[model samples]
Target: MSLRYKSAEESRVVISELMLPSHSNFSGKIHGGYVLSLLDQIAFACASKHSRAYCVTASVDTVDFLNPIEVGELVTMRASINYVGRTSMVVGIRVEAENIQTGIVKHCNSSYFTMVARDDEGKGIEVDGLLLENTTEIKRFLKAVKRIEMKRKRREEFDREDFVPEDYLSDLENYKVKVTCTDEL
Candidate 1:
């Protein structure tokens, strides 16, 4: 493993796999979880290779299941390291399924996964990052940035739900006690 990494634009597919019957659902269609796991595996490889360290999942911005893949079809999921941060790297993954025998293909899903690179002591480390030499991959890195921002803003907003002011009144009658309990919280 090399510590020098290329920019996001230079990230490329690290690995791929053909979907098998064991990876499908009861309906004989590839299961979303199975596909997700495959995406994670590929992304992990891309991140680990670039960062030259252990990479773990921090978050998945989104995954759109655009189509279905039958058990006999060949599902190819390609993952690329699209962006790098102080402690995190973003990987873009696209999945497509093709009828191996018929030679027909369809886009199945696409997503961005955020990964944290950790040293042997479980501390943060810098990644080699992608070179981002092309327009398409540059766009992907930009998109990953945007996706991360959106998810972050959403998390900030959602965190407010974890607390409620005494006067906010979960129930009108229950709003009486204003006692502060600091230790457990």
Candidate 2:
């Protein structure tokens, strides 16, 4: 009967774990894929906390690995709902790593996961709107709106009925890639 709203603070989730040797890649740094798994988990927790429903990750909007995390470092991830639609919410996550001995910290990653609330029958369910309490929250919500619009426009531009590969061939000339066309192609 009435619209419901929840604040970003209410949806916040934070977790910290020590990077272990088992989680390291061949080069001895923490694996990005492992970090991604953690990010997805936190996103789900934050979204579910906000909506009070089970949520599934519809898409990973962005993942920027700014720094490599090393084994033996303390990794912390913070997730919060940045935007909320009728059935979906964008969870913003920031990852940081700290060197225990030196007390040095570095930002490891920033990511956004779009999650959709689902019911028992796997149907999409309505979620409460975001309650923006401060300028920071307002900015994040606006940025999410812009990102959605940009993604829509990108899809339309690439999936146009008259799309032609040849038209974009020149666009790739500046890259280091070399294109070879087969007779059948």
Candidate 3:
């Protein structure tokens, strides 16, 4: 069979939901966990649309919450295929919250989810290649590539048998941690 390709627009998914009182946390703001759930849902939708198959989340590579969302606000999430590999795709999501009363919108979070397509038997399957059509799409794809490389390097460095905690101890000197068990470590 010939290889299939798709533009990011073909798989883009956008969802908007009203934040309810039940979605608020102790601080009276929408709980972060609730937002994460919506992000994952959109990511799955986008990936499945792109591959035309069942997809499973391989990882939540990044989630940055820039602003707090409040109850009674309208939360909108936009998801698109940012990068595609043999069997996996990186889904980029942008979240925003709009205060209905004020009509002001705030960027709440930006996230990246890695999803892998699966066949009927649940084995990983090849996904269609991404056709970058514009500069923004190209940039998103490139950023995903860099993020994957950085994550791989971080895992390799920390998982090495010769890894040393002391080597990175000094790197945290400026942080707020006290390191109470430094001697034990």
Cα lDDT of model 2 by residue, 38-80, tens digit: 9999999999999899999999999999999999999999999
Ten-residue region with minimum lDDT total, candidate 1: 164-173
Better of 1 and 3 by lDDT: 3
Candidate 1 accuracy as TM-score: 0.78
> What total of clashing residue pairs does each candidate reach?
10, 0, 0
TM-score of each: 0.78, 0.94, 0.94
Error of 3 at 55 (Å): 0.6
Model 3: lDDT equals: 0.96
Candidate 1, clashing residue pairs?
5-128, 6-129, 6-130, 6-131, 7-130, 7-131, 7-132, 8-130, 9-132, 10-132
lDDT of each: 0.78, 0.94, 0.96
Q: Where is model 1 more than 4 Å wrong at Cα?
A: 1-5, 8-11, 161-185
**Using lDDT as the measure, which candidate wins?**
3
RMSD of 2: 1.6
- Per-model root-mean-square deviation over C-alphas: 6.7, 1.6, 1.7
